[model samples]
Target: MKILTLNFLTCARKACKATNAAFPLHPRDAELEIVETDLNPLFIRNILPRIEWDALREICVELGLPTLPDAAPEPAALFAEPIVPADTMQDADEGAEKQPTQLLQDLHRLLLETTIATGKLVCGNCGHEYAVKEGIANFLLPSHLV
Candidate 1:
């Protein structure tokens, strides 16, 4: 499963629905794979506001990945230094081309290129383990857990 997906997922158990600890399921014995993917700066920038920075940082630490910044970066920081200010330019001939900064590329690699080939995502609140295989996460809850 992609790290990006974790932002929206939580413990499947109903009782853990409103719990603060249910989010950003902890990955255990994770087998990571690098799957190169196209970078989409616009999408990342748009979704930045919704990302849980602390949760993501925790996940990174648990997975033994590189640590992220303490705070989420502002959208404007994702782009390269433009010779011309964005507001003063047009889409085509009038503007300096906008490029993604190194940080943006790093975020793309961390969030999209990285995948879990096989692992268990354990919920902190309910102590439930969700299996991930072949990069697909199984969020199904058994009857008792449901």
Candidate 2:
């Protein structure tokens, strides 16, 4: 599943529901695949406001993926400004083009390109396991859990 989806998912167990720690289920033994797609800057900008930066960073660290900045830029600034580096102008004048903003590239890579092909998401609170296989994360809980 897309890492972006994890931003909204929480543990399904009745005991764990509606808790901050229960959301952003911890991934275990994750087999990740990178499938690139056309980058849509607009979509990335739109979604920035909703993403839980700390949770994303934690999951990336758990999966041994490259970590993001300790804090994300303000959503307003991301949407309103280019955020070009100080040296980008010099590079541009030297006949080299500045690439997409680093934040945009990282967000796209993490949220779009990366997929959890095999793994299990464990609830931080209840320790319930949601198995992921064949690139699909099964979030359905047992009847007792429901």
Candidate 3:
């Protein structure tokens, strides 16, 4: 678990670094941060439509994330949020109007490019803790858990 924890943080850091590189004028030295969540069943239900709830839940549990609710909820909520600093955004030239399309591009960079460089991911279901090292997740299941 200790090794896994270090690996998770390493992955997270790499992801964060990649994300920062994709943005224009983004802070080069921003530190990566991880948030551990204890997701309730209602929250899981709310996220079902937008995300692969089963997969996410499984990963969460395997990584020791918070457990979600049993009954899936209807009308999942939007999970989109600005993960980067507003000040890091590069504005268009003096008279140029900002394009809406770029926003989507930025979001994509933030979400996909970022890697969980090093950290521990605990499973919510079985209390398994997978370690992320060098931006890699060791999700190998133990003999009993497998």
Candidate 4:
């Protein structure tokens, strides 16, 4: 499986610029990295709810990646599983009606901090496989793929 891990610093910088938001923490170039994994059904099932499916699909298509089923039954089935941490659970209990800050933190960790150390990361929209090698992503695409 191909693995693709993005330089989080680069992504955040681009995002900040695009949204006109101040850069958080003045991150150095390539300092904070965001890695995308070529995950199996199981891993995808675990991550579906946390992910923005439309955005994921768009990225995948942009990268010429393989497409998944339009309806992910496995992910739906696994939605009830507690992907959040114990602290998040406590926070939820404390404020039943309010948004759980811990939950958001956990989501951030899963989506941004985790590294795609192994496996492939295909773009859902583009069907491109951004292979990861030695902690670097090979985003290069042939003319046809592009």
Best by lDDT: 1
Clash pairs (backbone) in predicted model 1? none
Order the candidates by TM-score, highest first.
1, 2, 3, 4
Give TM-scores for every candidate, taking all chains together and pairing residue i with residue i: 0.89, 0.80, 0.34, 0.30
Q: Name the top TM-score candidate.
A: 1
TM-score for predicted model 4 compared with the true structure: 0.30
lDDT of each: 0.88, 0.82, 0.37, 0.39
lDDT for model 4 = 0.39
- Kindly report which residue pairs in candidate 2 clash with one another: none
Off by over 4 Å in 1: 82-95
- lDDT: which is higher, 2 or 3? 2
lDDT of 3 by residue, 1-146 (tens): 22112222221222333542211111111223343333233333332355433443443344454565554333322233334446655643422422223333322222333335566554333334666566555756556554
Worst 10 residues of 2 by lDDT: 75-84
> How much does each candidate deviate from the true structure in C-alpha RMSD?
3.6, 5.6, 15.9, 13.1
- Candidate 3 lowest-lDDT run of ten: 21-30
TM-score preference between candidates 1 and 2, better one: 1
